[model samples]
Target: MVQNLTKRASPHNVNDRKEVLSGSCIEATASEIIQESNENMTVADAVAQMFENLGVKSAYGVSGGAMASLWGALSNSDIDVLNFRHEAGAAFAATEGYFASGNPTVVFTTAGPGITNALTGLFAARGEGAKVILLSACTSAPQRGRWAIQETSTDTLPSSGIFTTGTVFNYASTVESAAQLPQIFRKLAVGMSQPGGYVAHLTIPTAVQNMLMDETQLPEQGVSCSLVTADAQVVGNVAKLLRSGTFAIWLGFGARGAASEIRQLAEKTGAAVMCSPRGKGIFPENHPQFIGVTGLGGHGSVMTYMQEQAPVRTLVLGSRLSEPTSFWNQEMVPSEGFIHVDVDANVPGVAYPHAETIGIVSDVKAFVLQLLDILEAEEISESQLKASQPSSLPKPERSPVEAGSESLIRPEILMEAIQKVIVDGTDAVVMAECGNSFTWSTNLLRFSQANRYRVSTGVGAMGHAVTGVVGAAQARDGIAVAIVGDGAMLMNNEISTAVKYQIPAIWIVLNDARYNMCHQGMKMLGMTGADAIIPETNFEMIARGMGAKGIRVTKESEITAALETAIAANGPIIIDVLIDPDRPAPSKGRNKGLASQGVKSTSEQKPKVQASFPNI
Candidate 1:
């Protein structure tokens, strides 16, 4: 029904009639309904205001005519719009913005290919639970199915990719009319306010973008999102298991704010600590109780501890226990029992079915604090030992870099050089891309604070770190060091956006001339690495082409100086470092499962980690 937006046009309330009568009385359909006050403003202006109302101050996307109205309106407002070379890069950058600032950002794109091009990052955002607003321009209703240029039926709001029901987002819809915007904005407020990341796609038709609307019609911003502590039964159950036997505490990104309470609980219960890769530094990894990182280039200390100590109970806090982090191994899952705490109720018991599990749904911080109180009332002693990762699980020895100027730099030595150049929480933030970059960074570098380290283990997208660094550099008020592989840097528009914005992002490209992860994984499967190989390209030239500083490091002696130079640059820089491809990551044997299923291939070459100078 077309409801009256304001009380009947009165004798003296001139603004009321001027607000609702600019067009016909406010109209809404069954699918899209809105009822609120009125004002005199264009639909574009109202949408722009919706952004500010939801605490989002920045957005990233490409430009096209279909979204020109939104572009113009945003240009007139305080919102910062960052234009990028590709929609995927823009979307990834916005995802980083949310990660860095805790405020969801926007990704604006035109219809059809523009929208489809953004799906990769959107999928990444959903996978990682990063809050992002995907605002796209759609075809007008009249243009639907008429084969209009760049037109598709977005009206139905199909359920695929990020639009499905089972993921992080619970709502997805397009603006059917200008009147529907108030309710749409209400949903936006709710999504942004809630816990866990949310990705909402609001597609506006070109015709509707030009329609008139009212900013005052938007509902009042809702209450802050709140999650209860674990219910008494679940909390008591977890406490009982924790007190009864040898238990280890597992942490993740969700356990970020409760570091002190978590540490206290671990000490009281005599538990060791292990974390997901993204959860590094949330609990001091250097602490003794922190046995090692769980998956990827994770420490062998985990295997040693599990096989040796064999904790009778494991308390998992705010982690999915994903394949990349835990290798999805039977060994990683506890043999005795499990206690899993997560904000989402469904995630607690999902990863380990073989173990007796207690699932607790609550805020990580709240749960830890209350659990500490309970443990205190029951009198528990400090853990018998505090074990550091390096002491318990030292890094494997590297092949000696001969005393020659021509030898390629070892990956661990490169990481140490980068580590020396960092200030932990101040000077730079490390964003590691997927594949070998992830393994090396997670296994080699150590962080001292939360958010200082970031990896897309959930999304595991190759090119994410390079482009996402642009937004991180901008939002974090510090330099962003993107540890990326040769294969990933070439896949996105990292150099273009970084140069355009003059961001202080350093790309440490491990120029191995191959998708080394695939190369190594295939070898483990008894296949050759030939198809994974690519001719080594001079990435220094690529950076210089984009008006950014560039450097190439081939030897150990050059790494320290190169990192120092790149980190000191006034704008974006790329340090293309030659790493020995065959210096297989220390966690090489973690993939034995793949080795078990190896097929009989014609040619199989053993990985090369032995040190020798190769004449280039």
Candidate 2:
């Protein structure tokens, strides 16, 4: 099935080949090309070009001999190739980069442990709804099960989910021949063109990567796919349901693109809006109609609104309403049911299956726009909407800081500085790692714009933000800050990677010398004899050692100055703040959820200070 090309009048006329032989008969077959015609065009190069055509601007991973060809191909292309210290860090960074720039990114690994190490971040990408592709090396057919160096084969790795189209990836395959490029490219192009996130994997054997590919085998640059939208029947049904009774809107990360439409809908119907932790900025948090955030690190104002207003129906836009978002709290459920809209059809009734749900599979933006259209056509008056609105909506409140010069800084004071100096004062993207960092930031900070805040509520990995900030900063070509705890900072960080690339990323380390969340949660659960303490290591010293700027903040008053300095710096910087470990984060809801799940508290010693926020 090999095809050959003859000398043409021009190189561009030879099936659009950028490199073609002049005044020579091209005698190479599809599998093998003459050196004079497609000079040095390997299958790896073709794959890299295909990715570039698909709009991939960056590739991040650790390079090895097995993937030397791909590394060279990607390096030579216009895409920025970043050599990372660890494969997991690269994958995490790729995930954040896709979210920051709205462009799919690539994670390359050699084989075996390199591929395995990237699984965690890849899973996080899937959970957080990011488009990422993993390109890795695998053992050739001749070397299969023969104990090749860094062997990657079916004998060593399970192929069910990793190498096949299953839960882990929307599409997965092994590139055994160059001829498969057309189908692979089509699938990827279609997947990337569709709504929502799409994660894929393509494993190419080291030997096969060097094979020559015909120009006809290369995939086209792009594909066109229609947006997923609700049909008129579904839209009409949903509008009727919302019009029948009082309904509120629940926003999630998936609804980020429809911010303006969501605002219009909320204002038109006078419905209260609540969002998940990851969906913080999708709707303006400062708006009067915004009740509060829901789930872990959420506000009591949301619960207060639910109890007082007691909407008959809830319009859930793109939220999964999972444990972290709702804790599956029966109190939050409306009397009538939920009119849930999402791109994935399965997400509708899964979280709260017992409750009645009318699911509509459509892109959040398209669905919201259609709903607004229906409302507009109905000519719903502003006066009628005002009659249904609540007298006064509950607002989230936080306890006032004492403003003392304590030896250790308060988390509230640190968050206040972040709110003023970074969140509001600048356009830097802010991300909070899991544990106490997420709780403190989500519970305190307020966002007025979409895509300014990021948190991994799906996997909730510890080192995600620590390593991901680098990718975000590089992709956006601006300042990206990570609010991380000491344990996460010590576990995994890309200070060296950021320094290497000179990306202007910032890390604010809450140096409490302990896994404070674990320590505090264990105490709250009445667990005894648990060790969550870590040695106090100066993160500023670590950052400085890695050839990046560093600053240490020991007092609350020093936080603002340190942040201002870090933001002003042109390169990576770490602000190590000695935070008070005794102050409890707002995690009572999570503790209560754990208790209900049969986790019994065994000790009598309770947390000394319980951080409480009033429901305004």
Candidate 3:
């Protein structure tokens, strides 16, 4: 009965080849033999088994007819599926998971456009040196060249090779049978275990999904492998340079794994530690050796420190050092000598031209551990290490207010209230929209192990924060809070998605009437006449219309009460805090003068701009 069922579901056409079956070649049809063993398994079963062997915990993607069978397989397997608002959002969540845990994450999308939508996140993972597996379903094999619904050729995507910028050590195509599945999975494991990166794109035909496999012809499990280690001689030479010169360590998103070790190394070497925006929260900002972040949105003091006390050596670990993080200025980084450690060899010398750079291609954690060994061998004294540590900078004092009964809600006070209300055990995920809102969140919020904070690192997309909050809440099964500016809230209709899912995400709208950041920038540049004033809309009403709880707070005292009420409720909630539109957030050295000047006097509040609706 099993053999008959297998025969009926077998592929219609097959080509025969000489094979060592029972140590002899016989005249046999591949289709017949394959069909004979098809009764026990289906395409869905095979895919499930493959994922099981891979030890995948969960997968995220949208569902469609083309991917139904694969989804069924995943459902049957140990992996849980997370449906997302957008395919790209699903991919982004996967990327975040990879960052939090150094494990490769999987994302599956349906055919054609769905697959294309996931490309951005894939590119992000590749650039950040993350191991990610993207599985996309395609139309049935019979639909090739026929313009079937959602039909797309899988070959069009930049080969996993191109995506990795030529650093991918392994790549594989679709598996032909159950026997081939083990080999494909083995290759995937090896690729992920490699120092740099890996991608395996599996395409399945709708017609063959129900076909069974030949158990007798199953292939043996492939070999387990370890990551390629860096050359010891090269490591020793780099160690010598470190010992002889003053050095600084710059941590990027890729160096996430080595956070503790990086901190230790800086403490031991008296080297300063600076991180890129994505690398924020890796180390405690209050640490004595910390020098703050560097780049466009970073502290100006960091730039000053780097320029004045130019370190003779720089130890760059696990960073591609992209244009945005590098400030689009190669001259900012000294050209003298540096050791660039990355999983991918191609990333070390491409972005910046360094005079003497030794590329150590290995896992960030592994490389740091080995380097520690070498440092110990050099007999670096503990007392000397302690003596080299930089003194901690004192925290800046908060600005004092005059003795007046009248009060206004300060940004810092609002942040403190929100932070205080967030319960300790609640697994929270925070998303900060671009602009001063992010500036406030990055500086104020301290994420514990159970929490994660997200932002668009490269593109700096505005609407991503709101959408990301929804997706993240879905992924983590926890409360999500989105801190966004009124400007960003207007750019996207996020309330719609929140309402549709009935997700209990808290939306905190920093309702400043104008594009405050841009306005401040223009005023500082003496372009005061530039159009910076924007008529704000009623965000609370919009939330209410979308079937969410909307509360508006105009007074400073009402902020905490409003937040308490929102946090206690169940579904989506929006708290529009009517902040003093003129207040400026804490600024770096470059913008300190402008911020200190205070908001254009209340009398000069942009001429009381009139619009159809009340702002905030």
Q: What C-alpha lDDT do the candidate models reach, one value each?
A: 0.74, 0.85, 0.62
Error of 3 at 107 (Å): 2.9
Residue 230 local lDDT, model 2? 86
lDDT of 1: 0.74
Candidate 3 deviant stretches above 4 angstroms: 1-40, 100-103, 128-130, 154-180, 195-200, 216-225, 328-335, 386-413, 416-429, 434-437, 443-452, 470-480, 485-507, 511-553, 561-616
Full candidate order by TM-score, most accurate first: 2, 1, 3
lDDT per residue (tens digit) for residues 448-510 in model 1: 677788899787877799889888886665588899999998889568777777778889999
Best by lDDT: 2
Clashing pairs in 1: 270-383, 288-387, 288-388, 289-387, 295-325
Specify the highest-TM-score model's number.
2
In angstroms, give how far residue 321 of model 2 lies from its true place.
Answer: 0.9
TM-score per prediction, in order, is 0.86, 0.91, 0.74
Distance from true location, Cα of 9 in model 3, Å: 22
In candidate 2 the C-alpha lDDT for residue 291 amounts to 91
Comparison by lDDT, 2 against 3, better one: 2
Global local distance difference test of model 3: 0.62
lDDT of 3 by residue, 1-616 (tens): 0000011121211221123332365555665555643455676667655564565555667777877877776655555566665676666656655544445667788888888777666655554455677776766666766778876654444545422334432353654455666666777766765655454556566665666665523233534667656778877887777776567787776676567877767666777777666676566566766676654345655655655666676788767677435543433465465688887777787767645676788777777778788888879785664453344432322345444223556677777777777633355667777777776665555543212566555555555566556545544545778888888777653455556556567889888777776776555444547776778677789888888889987777787789788767676788888776666655553232122234232233442222110010
In angstroms, the error of model 1 at 356 is 0.9
Worst-scoring 10-residue span by lDDT in model 1: 607-616
